[model samples]
Target: MKDAIFEVNNVSFSYEEANEKAMDQVSLSVPEGAFYAVLGQNGSGKSTLAKLLNGLYLPTSGQVLVCGMDTADEKNTWDIRQNAGMVFQNPDNQIVATIVEDDVAFGLENIGVAPTQMPGRIEQALLDVGMLEFRERAPHTLSGGQKQRIAIAGILAMEPRAIIFDEATAMLDPQGRKEVFAAVQKLNREKGITVLWITHFMEEAAQCQHVYIMEDGRIVMEGAPEEVFSLPEKMQALRLDAPAAARLAHRLREAGMPLKAGLLHMEETAKEVARACKLNSKA
Candidate 1:
């Protein structure tokens, strides 16, 4: 598609001396400015796919394109990375500078961004991630969520077309995860930036516009969250779980209550339960 920010066509990849392909013939398209999620269990190849999109790993077979540039071509590597920035699980590994603002500027410095143009970019990036007030604070002094936002600010400084989170919230606590997730969603919604979120959390995946489920090195399912999570049996077969609301709805239905499928949010599920049971407001 012409609007695709990422085009993976029949791509497969294997690690050095690996016994088998980590990803096999995976094909997907991420439209420009779309929020997409890839869900999988460990060793299910989602992370490997993330690396391919960012040009960190080239496909062993077939092609991976980012904004019309082929990742296999050595010349496209630098531009590909700049356009498709990646945030890994560990924020500490991504932080290089002691101070928050300097860490965000580290990428701009490496790319030789004109010194005159850097202040505005740095300040805006920090503000975008809600970290401007912490510009002078030491990176180590910030909480996990703050550190992750700083990492995102670094990517935003590059003015990336897309940002891929490779289990970026895996190590965060509930509050930390909420903070980072909010920042990511804000960037996608407000800045028109594309997002490819790789995660195992079903609830997090539910927030995205599209979801791809991977199992045993291939895409086992792809659809909107409601479409995918409606099948509890298939999700479990892939070693995945439905979001809490969906699970509760499924159990209620099985117990002889009349409820609809694909109930993904709590408020909707609560309303449905009340209607099905003919409960009064007090109940």
Candidate 2:
């Protein structure tokens, strides 16, 4: 991929004093401006991979390149992080300042963005996340999704090339999750920022352009959502379930109903099921 924003080449990582590798010989590329998902159950090495991409953890072996800068190179570390910002699972841990706008400006202040230019950048970032209206509000007063959006705003102010969301929506309620996902989707669609979303949410993965499934420190599956979720037995062996609609469609097919393979979303599944029923009635 000539436009690859992140290149993980034969990467492996292990914690100090740990007996096993968290990731083993894993390799993948995220194309520029693509919404990519890395899905796995807990202990699947997805989070470790996210940390390596952001320079929080160096690979024990192999290499990770962010926007073409080698992450393991000491000199390239700062630049790599600047180009590939991270949003972790906890929003509270990410926010620094009391007020929303100030929190968004924290990264800019660290990089010594000119005071005259800070307002414009901060305002834009907040606006991008749909949090401009709460610029003056205190961080603690915001909802979980709002805080996550603020965290994202902080990253956006730094003008990053890509963003890694490490289970960023896991802690939120359904509405909150929807809000944060919508904000991130808007960023990817309108601003053309590349996204790496690490989550166990199958529905979320279905929305991504590409999906990679990790298990036992390796990428066991990689493809478009339809291609991936099509294999129900394989996904089951990995201790992961296919998306709800896909599973339903599979069961219906096994029960002697005609249905298309790899039905991912509810709307599509409903239409297919209805069509099958109508055809059966005609017979």
Candidate 3:
């Protein structure tokens, strides 16, 4: 029922040099403040879609609209980029300043924010990402996750309504991934920022409100996380895996256990298994 923050209407895009389209007839709408996950194998157009949403790549055909502004229109390009900021895989690529606070100020500086107002925005953005304590530290001295958070802070300072995370956790270690994921999740939950999370990690996608699976530059499946992930065959066909908890739960169901659907988390799945055991013992 919420207003759409992003709308893709029957869009198709081909690369200048490639024989095949990078995106093909894709249509999707992301409501304001929604968390949407996009899953895909390599070269599946997920990244291309991110670029399109942020105005880095205009759709070759059809349309991509961010905050109701068409991306193909050159006039809307600047506002669209600010309206839908992007966080990419590499933190170092986005970190332009020496100190943590300074990096957070980079975007604000580009937009010509008043000198006096910069401090408050920088402080708030760092605080949102839980990196305020490290404000004075050198960016290169920080851990990967911390650097990624700083990268996020840079975007957050600009106060964009939406953010496109294009495999933002791909280069991180498990803990680093968790750190970055938690930060983004907090922003989505507390601040109501719309999120477009592009990832190959099934567990990460399992936690989102909506899921879309891409294969060969097209959306092959989309629904609530439970609905899309419940079909393991389609995931397997695309060379993707369901979350570990979901996979194990599916096996238990096949073995005649009356476990419920949408068991995406390990703790929840374990609890359900224990309850099922209790019922069996009673029987």
Steric collisions counted per model: 0, 0, 0
What do the candidate models score in CA lDDT, each in turn? 0.93, 0.94, 0.92
lDDT of 3 by residue, 1-283 (tens): 9989999999999999999999999999999999999999888888999988878888888998899999989999889888899999999999999988888888899998999999999999999999999999999999999999999999999999999999999999999999999999999999999999999899899989999889999999999989888877777888999888888999999999999988889999999999999999999
Full ranking by lDDT: 2, 1, 3
**Model 1 Cα lDDT, one tens digit per residue, 82-140:** 99999999999999999888898899999999999998999999999999999999999
**Worst ten in a row by lDDT for model 1:** 274-283
Record all residue pairs in model 1 with backbone atoms less than 3 Å apart, i.e. clashing.
none
Candidate with maximal TM-score: 3
Count clashing residue pairs in model 2.
0
- TM-score against truth, every candidate: 0.96, 0.97, 0.98
Better of 2 and 3 by TM-score: 3
Score candidate 1 by lDDT.
0.93
Candidate 2's residue-wise lDDT over 187-283, tens digit each?
9999999999999899999999999999978999999999999889999999999998999999999999989877999999999999999999999
